[model samples]
Target chain A: MRILGIDPGLTRCGVGVVDAEGRAVRLVAVDVLRSAADEPLEQRLHRIASGVEAAIVEHRPDAVALERVFAQHNVRSVMGVAQISGLVLRAAAANGIAVELHTPSEVKAAVTGYGQADKRQVGAMVQRILALESVPKPADAADALAIAICHAWSARSAAPTAALTPAQRAWQAAERASRR
Target chain B: MRILGIDPGLTRCGVGVVDAEGRAVRLVAVDVLRSAADEPLEQRLHRIASGVEAAIVEHRPDAVALERVFAQHNVRSVMGVAQISGLVLRAAAANGIAVELHTPSEVKAAVTGYGQADKRQVGAMVQRILALESVPKPADAADALAIAICHAWSARSAAPTAALTPAQRAWQAAERASRR
Candidate 1:
């Protein structure tokens, strides 16, 4: 299975794609979307959305994973973040892709064997697990890869014998036919 | 002077432009950018940035006003919002336009004469101030316009009496020349 992990932000969003088979996971792509300083909010959002869509199309992941939003002290800021999340969710839904949301604690626990691991620790764990030459830079990119790793681990652990349901099987058949 | 207000989001971002002179403010443009659900985040951001750049080029606003990020309990969510804000700031800065950031409460107070005003009240106040046929739609657009109005009021109240300093004058001349 291929999984796409996202670290969504307004200024820069990090995305990572990974292919998982049994216990092995390999990184497919990792990149960031950056917005110019003078761009309007609406315009920036468009660019972000477009970049995400392109990534999804390029990777064609079986599942998409995202970090869930937690509550905040600032209502306005929370609302804005919620709005960003809304877009991310909508984009996933539109693609008819199943999205899995994970909390920071859950992602950390899966990646680093701790629920409250700091960024550096998480980065280290990701580097160790992915066997990368060095840690992913910009922190966001590492977080995105970590999210993908967490999803692969969770899915493998939870569904040893899980396969496509009858409905999903039919849908896949239809999709294959349509593509041909 | 023309001021543009932006309400940034991931899926939909609202933008409003208004002309300000002394105590008077007139609406010029109000629009929202909608992105497809299946699109990539990077692509979405690019679209948003380009759209805002177009608007800026079209309106040639004197200043840009935006909502500031406040503290949030959700670190992940706050980070996402911060990313969006960063893009917006970048867009503005790239165009040599200064930006003024406002808190949600400040925007509410400026638009509705109530720091704790409800969305409806704020919408009504925006309508009243703009003398429009109706309140702006999708709420975000109205809120963006309200931010612009707030800046307009603030700028008028704190109008400068002296002419631009020599350095300021030279900078303005260069900016004007660059545009031409």
Candidate 2:
């Protein structure tokens, strides 16, 4: 399964795509879409929307995972996050993609095995899990990859073992062997 | 000038259009676009976006006036408003129509000469100002009309007095005379 994860913001939106088979996952793409802070709100929204649309078209992920916004966060930035998330949700829907929202703690726990993990811990776990040469840059990109990993892991667990395809079963066995 | 005002919400979005020549204002259209609460978020957003887009195309308003959302408002409902407002802002930008956001107090003050006017007072003032036979139904619809009126009055005031067209001046004089 392929998933696109988004860390939505008005000034900078993080997008990451990952492909997973059984317990193994690999990064397909990761980048941040940036817009100038000084730009008009409409133009900023349009820029972010277009970027997200382009990513969806380019990656063709089966599902999208977005970080849920909490109003209790920095009041100003939270609004921007919510607004950008709206556009992202709309774009995903237009393309017939299923979307799931994950809270920050959920993502942290999924990626680092600890809900209280800080950015550094999450980044370290993401790099180790994906076996990347280095952690993704600018924090946002790494956070997006973590979100994808979260969805990918949860999605795998959600599937019934009996429903696993032959290839998935084989991959799972190989993963188990490697862990030994 | 014709202005389209939107009270953005996920379940029911209020839209109102009005034409204004100086201080004389008349309602052009008013409506409440609704979506089922049980509908998915993306579908709800799409429904509202389509409705606003269609309104813009049909009315060809010179500007859009949207109620500004406050984070301090109902926490759950505020997110919906912000999300819907994002979509509305993008639609207006795509259509090349300028959008201005007015606070609730501003709308009340513009319509009823009191910033703290209640809904009933605002609706009554809307009916009186527009010379309508009855107040527009649904508080959302009336609120929308009040927002448009707010924008119309502010836009007129923002324009330098010397820039007023002959027709606008004549309408202003006639409105003043009729008031006498």
For all the models shown, what interface RMSD does each have?
A: 8.4, 0.9
Please give, for residues B33-100, the per-residue lDDT of candidate 1 as tens digits.
Answer: 76665776545655665677788889988888888766544465455455456566656765777777
True-contact fraction in model 2 equals: 0.55
Best candidate (score: DockQ): 2
Stretches > 4 Å off in candidate 2: A156-162, A166-180, B155-162, B167-180
Error of 2 at A25 (Å): 1.6
Worst 10 residues of 1 chain A by lDDT: A155-164
Weakest lDDT window of 10 consecutive positions for candidate 1 chain B: B155-164
- Scored against the true structure, residue B167 in model 1 reaches a CA lDDT of 81
CAPRI-style grade of the A/B interface in model 1: incorrect
TM-score of each: 0.57, 0.88
* B111-144: candidate 2 lDDT, tens digit per residue: 9999999999999999999889999989889999
Give the number of the best model, judged by TM-score: 2
Chain A of candidate 1 scores what in TM-score?
Answer: 0.84
TM-score of chain A of each: 0.84, 0.88
Off by over 4 Å in 1: A7-16, A29-64, A72-100, A112-128, A131-143, A156-180, B7-15, B30-62, B69-98, B108-143, B155-180
- The superposed Cα distance between candidate 2 and the true structure at residue B14, in angstroms, equals 0.5
